[model samples]
Target chain A: MSYFSDIYKGIKTLLTGMSVTGKYFLTSRKGAITQQYPDNRATLKMFDRFRGEVIMPHNENNEHRCTGCQKCEIICPNGTIEIIWDRGIDEETGKKKKKIDQFVYHLSMCTMCALCIDVCPTDAIIWGQNFENSVYDRTKLTRVLNEPESKLMPGVED
Target chain B: MALREKNNKPNSLKTNNLELGTQNMKPETINSNFKSEEYQINMGPQHPATHGVLNLLLTIDGETIKKVEPDLGYIHRSIEKMCERDSYQQIVHLTDRMDYLSSNINNEAVCLAVENALELEIPERVKVIRTIIGELTRISSHCLWWGVMGMDVGALSTFFYGFRDREMLNDIFEETCGARLTMNYNVPGGLMLDIHPNFVKRVKKFVTHFKTKIPEYDRLLTENVIFQKRTKGVGVLSKEDAISFGVSGPVARASGYSCDVRKYHPYSALDKVTFNESLKTEGDTFARYQVRIQELWESLSIVEQLIDNIPEGEYRVKTNAVIKLPKGEFFQKVETARGEFCVYIISTGTKSPYRLKFRSPGFSNLSVLNHIAVGGKIGDLVAILATLDLVIPDIDR
Candidate 1:
C-alpha cells in the first residue's frame, strides 16, 4: 500500500504543476500579449520623459536662456561639457547678461544622466530624445548646442 | 581507543574524524586514526550556479568540502580608472553596468557617494522619484531571483511567470530612461527627468496587478510540499556564520541578523518611506524565500505610499557639467535585492575616479557554497546554488 501510495502522490504532484502551466497557456489574458518590436515600430510611442541627449533651445526674441553660470559644467563628474562665454550689455536694466558663445556637449562620453539639465538655473538645456547617438567620428558628438550667432539673452529664460 | 571512539558520534560511518567540540573521552591510543589525502573539485568560471565568472577551488573528501578558495578577476572592468578620464556627471551612468539587474540601485549608490563628496543638495521631487525607481528595481530583481530559485527546485513554470511580470517593469523603465537594464538616470544632485505624466497611475496599476498575482506564485512554488522538504533544513547558515562572512541584505536578515543598510543607515529619503525589513531566523533556503516574498510586499507598499505624494520641484541640483571632486575617497553601499553591494571610489580630485572597486553581494554569497554543500546530496546543491541567485556577469565583473 505504501509503495503504490507514494507513486500515486508523485504523479498527482506532477499533474498539478502541469495544470497551472496549461491554465496560463490556454486561458490567461496576458498569454496573447507579445511585443512584436521591429514590426510594431510604427505604432510604438517613445515617451517624452526620456532623457536621451542635451540640446540648448532658444525661444521668442531669439534669446538664449543660459547665463553661463557653469553649474552644469562643474557638477558633471566627467569632463564632457565645454562652455565659452560672450559678454554683452543688456538694455533692460543696464545689467550685463552673459551669453554662451558656444556650449559643447560630448555625447560619446555622456552617460545619459540628466544631472546637468537638472542643475541648470534657466531652462536653457533639455535632453533630446535622440537614440541615434552613434557616429563614425567622436568629434561629431562634441556638438555646439548654442550657436555663437543666435540672438541670446544673458540669464533670461527663453 | 574504545573510550575515544565511544564519546564521538562521527559525522560519517567510515571517516576517522576526531575533531568535535572536544575529544571528551581520554584516548587510550592516538595512532588508530590516519589522515587521508584530500580530493580536488572545480567550481565555476562557467558552472550554472557559480553566479557569474567566479571559479572556486573546492578541496573535498567525497562530498564534504574541506578547503575552499575563491578565484576572482575574471570580469574586472576598470570602471574606477575610467571615471578619472570622464567628468563627475558622466561616471554616474557607468555605475549602472556594475550590477546590471539592479541598475537603479547601482546608479544611486555611486551618485550618492559623489553627492556626499561635493555636498550637493537634491530636490524634494527627485527624492520621491528615486525611491519609486529604487523599489521598482528591487521588485524586478526579486522577480528574477524568484524564477531562478524555482528553477533550482526543478519547478519550471514559475520562471516563465517571473519573467512575464518583470518584463512589464522593463518596458516602463525603457520608456522613462531609454534603456531597460542599465538606466543612467541618477545624477550628482537629482534624477535625470521628472516622473512621466502617467507614471503614477501606471505604477498604481502595476502594483494592483502584482498583488493579485502573488498568491499564484505561492500556489505554484512556495506552498509545494517538495520545495518545503528540500529547503527547510538544508544549507542552514547560522546567525553567527552570516555575520562573520559579512553577509548583509536578505541573506543576513534571513538568518535573524538585523543588518539592513536602509534601516541602519538610510540614504536618499529612505527614512521618510514607511517600510519594515523582512526577516526570518531559520537561515536556510526556506527562510531566504520567506524574506524575499515578504520584501516584495513591503516594496509594493512603499511604492503605493509615495507614488501620488510626489512633490513638484526641480528634478536635479544646480551643478556644472565638467565637475571635480574634492580630494578624498568616497565609499557607499546599497542593498540590492541580493544583498549589500559596495562601490569604493578613490578620488584623485579629478573628473574621473582614480580607483573604483565594486564589492558585490553575489561574490560573497557564492563563496559560502563549500561550507553548505558538504553532506547534502548533489541535487540539493542545485537548490542551494539557486537559492543564492548567482548572476554570472555580476560575479564576473
Candidate 2:
C-alpha cells in the first residue's frame, strides 16, 4: 500500500540526515572551528576598519589636525562628543582665533558608528583598533582625545 | 416613596440573583465533584525558545494550544519617536537594532527612502556592492535561522554548523564595515566605505565552501525522519489566510504567494542578477523551511553574479552636511532576509523627519502565530514558531 511506501521513505530520509551529521562527528577534532577565546588572545588580531574608539592622531612635534570645529559634536546622534574651546592668540598670524581646550569623548555613549570620523573635515579623528574597551567605572570611559600639550597643526586653520 | 422604591429595586434584584444562585448550587451540592480547567502558561519575555524578549500567553488543554496571545513591547525603544528627533543621516544607525539579523537590508531601506526623496543617482559601483552585501546578509540570516530551526526541532548540531558558516560572513562584514551584527554601513547616498580588498576573494571562497556544506546540512537535518515528522503538514498557513494575515517572506512564499519584493520591485542591482524566488504550495512548517533553504542557494547565486562584476567608481556620493528631505511623503521597501521591510518618512522640509514609520515584516508574520498555532500541540508550536523565524525586536519596534 501507499502507506507502507511512505513509512519506508521516511526512514530512508532520516538515515540520510544522520549520515551527514555522522560524517562530521567522525571528522571530529580536526573539524572543530571554535577558537578558545582567552587562550587564543595572544594570537588574535582585529581588522583595520574595526571601530573601537575615536582617537586623534598627533605628529612628532605634538601638532594635531583638530581645529575644534565641533562638527563631530553636532553630527553625533547622541551627545557623545563635548568640544570645549576658548579664543586664543594665533602664533603665526598674531590674531585671535578659536582653539581647542578639550576634545572630550564618552566611550559608553559611542555607538562605534564612525559617523563622526566620516564627517570630520580636517581628518583629525580616526577609529583606533583597540577593541578591549571595558571599564570598571563609567567615568573612566570618558577621555580627552588630544594630548595634554598638543596644538593645532599649521595650515589646518585655513 | 418613589425614590425609596427605585433604590430598593437594586436590593430586590440582588435577592432574586441570590435565590437563583442557591437554586443552582443545590444541584452541585448534591453531586460534589472537581472539574478540570484549561491551563494557562506564560512562555516568556525571558524564555530561550522565544528567540528574544517575546511573551506568548498560551491557553492549553492537555498539551494542545487552545489560544496564543503575543504580549509585545518588552524590547520596544520607541525607535519611530527617536527618528523624529534624529537627523536623516543619524537615523540609519537606529534601524540596525531592529531585525538585527538583516541590519544591512534595514539600513538599505532607510537609505533608499532618503535617496528616492532627493532623486539621487547612485553610482553603478554602489549599486553592485550594495546588492552583493544584501545577498550576503540574506544568506547569513538564513544560515542562522536554519541552525536555530534545527535546534528548535530537537536537532542541536545544526546550531553549531549554522553559526560556523555565519561567523565567516560576520568576519567578512566586520572586515568591511567594522561592526559584525549591527553593520550601519549604508548612508543615504551610498555605502559608508568601499569593500575591503579581500572582500571579493573571501566571498568567492565562502561561496565554494558553503556550496559543499549545504549537502551536509541536508544530511544532518533536512532529510531526517524525526525532523520531517515534527514539521511536515504541521501549522499549515493557506494562501488565503496567509494573505489575509499579511504574512510575507518565506512564510508567504510557502503558501504560493508570489510577493517577493526583489522580484516585483527590483531595486539596486537586483534587476541585474538572475535568481529564482523560492516558492512552495504546501504552506506548512516544512514548506517554510524548504523555502528558506532554496532561498539560500538563490542568495548565493545573486552574490556570485555581483561580486566579480563590482563596477569601479566612488563608494559614496558627496551629499550635503545637513540632509533635508523635501516637504512631502517618501516611502521605500526592500526585501530583507525575512520579507518586505518598508520605511515611510514624512518630511516637513527639515533635517529631521516629521514622522517615520517602519513597516517591519516580523510584525505581520507574528500576527499569524495565533491563527496557525492555536490548534497544534504544545511541542508543534515550537516548530511553527521556529519556521516563523520572528525577530522580536522588529515586532516590538
Candidate 3:
C-alpha cells in the first residue's frame, strides 16, 4: 500500500515540475529571453560603463589630451600601454617639454581592469564601447591609440 | 591451485567441501573461480561533469567506485606566483580568474587585507555598497550552480531559467564595474568608482524579480521526487568527517558545522545586516543542495536590507599612487559563494607582497570527495561532484 502511494506522490511531483516548464512553453513567444544577436546589431547597445577596449579620443583639430605623462603606462597591471616620449621645444615657452611619440596599446594582453583609465591624469584614455575585438592575426591586436600626426591638445599641460 | 592450498582460508573451505561430498574436487575448486577486478577510469580533464578542467582518476570495481583521485593543475595559471610580481592594487584583478563566479568577493578579500595592513578607515558608504554587491554576487553564483546542478542530474530546463535570472545580475555588474565576470571594483582603499545612476533602481528590480522566481525554482527542481531520490541518501558526509576534511561553505554547513566566516568574522558591513547561517544536519548531496538554496534567499534578504539605505558619500578614499604595505603579515577572509576565501599577504614594506597565498574553499572541499565517493556508483560520483559546486580554477590556483 505504501509502495503504491509512493508512485502516486512521485507522478504528482513530476507533473508539478513539468507545469513550470509547460507554462513557459505556452508563453514562449512573449517570454523568450534570448536576444537575436547580429540580427539586432543596430539595436544592441552596451552600457555606458562597459570596458570594451581603451581608446584615446581625439578632437576636431586632431588634438588629444595626453601630455606624455607615463602615469597610465606605470599604473597598467599587464604593461598593456607603452608610451614613447621625446623632449621637444614648446612653441610658446621655447623650452624643452615632454611630447608623446607613440602610445602603443596591446589589446590582447589587456584584462580590462580599468586601472589605466582610473589613473589617467588628463582623461586621455577612455573605455571604447566597441567590443568586437576579434582579429585573425595576433599582431592586429597591438594598436597605436593616437591617430597619426595628432598633436597634444594646447593648455592640457596646465 | 598450489597457492590456494598454501592458504589457511582455502584449507577451511576444503574441509567444509569434503563434508559436503565434494572431496574428489581439487582444493582450489573449493573457492569460486568468479573474480572481480578493480579497474581505473579518468572522469575528466575534458568531461562536462567535472565543471572545469579537473581530472578525476576513478578506480572502480564494476559498478561501484573504489577510489576517486583528483588530478589538478590543468587550468593552473600560478595566480599566487603572479601576485608576488604584481603591486597590491594589480593583485585584485588576478584573483578574479581564481573564482570567476565570485570575482567581486575575491577582489574584496584582497582589498580588505591591504586596507587592514595599511589600517585605512573604510567609510560607511563603501562598506554598505560592498556588502550589497557581495551578496548579489553570492546569489548569482548560486543561481548558476542551481542550474548546472539540475543539468548534471538530467534536468535541462533549469539551465535556461537559471541563465535568464543570472543575465540580469551580469548586466548590473557590467553597468557598475565595467566588466561582467571579472569585476575588479574593490580597490584597496574603497571602490574604484561611484555606483552608476541606475545601480540602485536596477538592483531593486532584480530583487523583486528574483523573489518571485525562487518559488518557481522549488517547483521545478527542489520538490521533484527524482531529484530528491538521487541526492537524499547519496554521498553522505558526517559532521565529524566534514570538519576533519576542512571543507568550508555549504558542503561543511550541510553537516551541521557552524563555520560561516561572515557570521563569525563579519567584514564590510556584514555585521550591520542580520542573516542566519543556512545549515542542515543530513550532510548528504540533498543537504548541500538545500543549504545553498537557503543561502540564495539569505543573500536576497541581505541585499534588500541594505540596497535602499546606501549612505551617500565618496566612493573611494584617495590612496597613494604607489601603495607600500608596512612590513608584516596580513590576512583577510571573506565568505564567497563557495566558502571562506582567505588572502594571506606577507609584505616586506614593498609595493608587492613578498609571499601571497590564497586559501580557496574548493581545494579543501575536493579533498573530501575520495572519502565519500568510495561506495557510490559512477553516476553517483557525478552527482556528488556537482553538489560540491567546485570552480576548478579556485582549487588549481
Candidate 4:
C-alpha cells in the first residue's frame, strides 16, 4: 500500500512542477522578457544619469570651459586623461595664461568609474549617454575632446 | 589524492569479480564492460556546469566521482594588489568585479569599513536605502542561482522564470544608479546619489508582483519529483563539517549552524526590521535549496517594511575630494547572497590603502566541495555544485 502511495505522490508532485512550466509556455508570447537588442535600437532609451563616455560641452561660439587645470588627469586612476596645454596670451586681459592645446582622452583605458567627473572643478566634462562605443581600430578610441580652432570661453579664468 | 586512487582500485576489482561470477558472464562481456579503470577528467575553465572559468579535475570510477579538485586563479585580477594603488573611494568599485552578483553589497562592505575607520555618522536615509538595495541585490543574485541550479540539473524553464523576475530589479537599479550589474552606488560616506523619484513606487510594485511569482517557482522546481530526487539526501554536509569548512550563508544555515550574519551582527537598518532567519536542520542539497527559497520571502518582507519610510535628508555627506584614511587596520563583514563577505584594509594615512584584502565568501565555500563531492555520482555532483553556487571570480579574487 505504501509503495503504491509513494509512486502516486511522486507522479503528482512531478505533474505539479510541469504545470507551472506549461502555464508559462502557453503565455510565453505575451510575456516574453527578452528584448531584440539591435532591432529595438530605434526605441532604446538610456537613463539620464547613465555614465557612457566623457565629453566636453562646447557652446555656440565654439568656446569650452576647460581651463586645462589637469584635475581630471590627476584624479584618473588609469591615466585615461591627458591635458596638453601651452602658455598663451589671454584675449580679453592680454596677460600670459595657460591655454589648452589638446585634451587627449583614452577611451580604451577608461573604466567609467566617474572619479574624474566627480572631481572636475569647472564642470568641463560630463558623461555622454551614448553607450555604443565599439570600434574597429584602437587608435580611434584615443579621442581629443576639444575640436580644432576652439578656444576658452570668456570669463573662464583659473 | 594518491592514497584514494590506491584504495579505489581494490574496490573496483572486487566489484568487477562480482560482476563476472554472477550469472557466469562470458569473457567477451567482461572485456567490453565500460567500468574498467578509474579515470580522471577535467571539467573546464570553459565547461558550462562550472558557472565560470573554474577548472575541476574530477577523478571518477564510471559515473561516480572519487574526488573533485578545484583548479582556480584563471580569473585572478590581483584586485587586492590593485586596491593598494587606488584611493579609498576608488577601492569601492574594485569590489564590484569580485562577487559581481551582489556588487552593491560588496561595495557597501568596503564603504562601511572606511566609514567605521573614520567614525563618521551617516544619515538615516542612507542607512535605510542601503539596506533596501542590499536586500534587492541579494534577491536578484539568488534568483540567478535558482535559475542556474535548475538548468544544471536538467530543467531549462526555471532560467526563464528566474530572469523574468530579475529584469524588474535590473530596471530599478538602472533608474537609480545607471549601471545594471555593478551600480557602484555606495561611496565612503553615503550613496553616489539620492534614490530615484520613482524608486519607492517601483519597488512596491515589484514586491507585490514577486510575492505571487515565488509560489510558481516552488511549483516549477521545488516540489518537482525529478528535482527532489536529484537534490534530496544528496551532498549531505553535517553541521560540524559546515563549521569546520567555514561555510556560511545558505550552505551553513541549511546545516542548522545558526550562522546568519544579519541576525548576529546587524548592520545599517537591519536592526530596525523584523524577519526570520530561514534555517533547516537537514544539510542536503534540497535543504540548501529550501533555505534560499525561504530567504527570498524574507528579503521581500524586509523591502516592504522599509519602502514607505525612507527619511528625507542629505543623500551624501560632504567629504574632501581626496580622502585619506588614518593609518590603521580596519575590517568589516556583510552578508552577501552567497555568504559573509569581508573587507580588511590597512591604511598608512595616505590617499590609497597600504594593503587591502578581501575575505570573499566563495573562497571558503568552495574549499568544502572536495570534502562533500568525493563519493557522489556525476549527476549528484552537478546538483551539489549547483547548490554550492560557486562564482569563480569570487573564488579566484
Tell how far residue B193 is off in model 3, in angstroms.
1.2
- What is the C-alpha lDDT profile of model 3 across A32-137, one tens digit per residue? 7798998999999999999999999999999999998899898788899999899999999999999999999999999999999988889999999999998899
As for DockQ, the candidate ahead, 2 or 3, is 3
Error of 1 at B156 (Å): 2.1
For candidate 3, write residues B1-397 as lDDT tens digits.
Answer: 4433544465476556545564455666646445777889988899999899999998999989998999999988889998889898899989999999999999999999999998999999999999999999999999999999999999999999999999999999999999999989999999998999999999999999999999999999999988998998999999999999999999999999999999999999999998999999999999999999999999999999999899988888989999999999999999999999999999999899999999999999999999999999988998999999999999998
Q: Backbone collision count in every prediction?
A: 29, 2, 0, 0
Predicted candidate 2 versus true structure: per-residue lDDT over A78-154, tens digit per residue? 89999999999988789999999999999999987788998998999998988888878989999999899899998
lDDT tens string, model 2, B241-280?
9999998999999999989999999999999888898999
TM-score of chain A of 2: 0.87
Model 2 residue B176 lDDT?
96
By DockQ: ranked, best first: 3, 4, 2, 1
Angstrom error at residue A155, model 3: 0.9
Model 3 DockQ class: medium
Worst ten in a row by lDDT for model 2 chain B: B1-10
Q: Judge candidate 4 against the unseen true structure and give its global Cα lDDT, from 0 to 1.
A: 0.90
DockQ of candidate 1 is 0.21
Interface RMSD, every prediction, one decimal place: 3.5, 1.8, 0.9, 1.6
Give per-residue CA lDDT, model 1, range B83-162, as digits (tens).
Answer: 66776666777777677888899888888888888888777788788888999999999998898788777787787889
Residue B14 in model 1: shift from native, Å? Answer: 41
Off by over 4 Å in 1: A1-16, A28-31, A48-158, B1-43, B57-69, B327-331, B343-357, B395-397
**Rank by lDDT (best first):** 3, 2, 4, 1
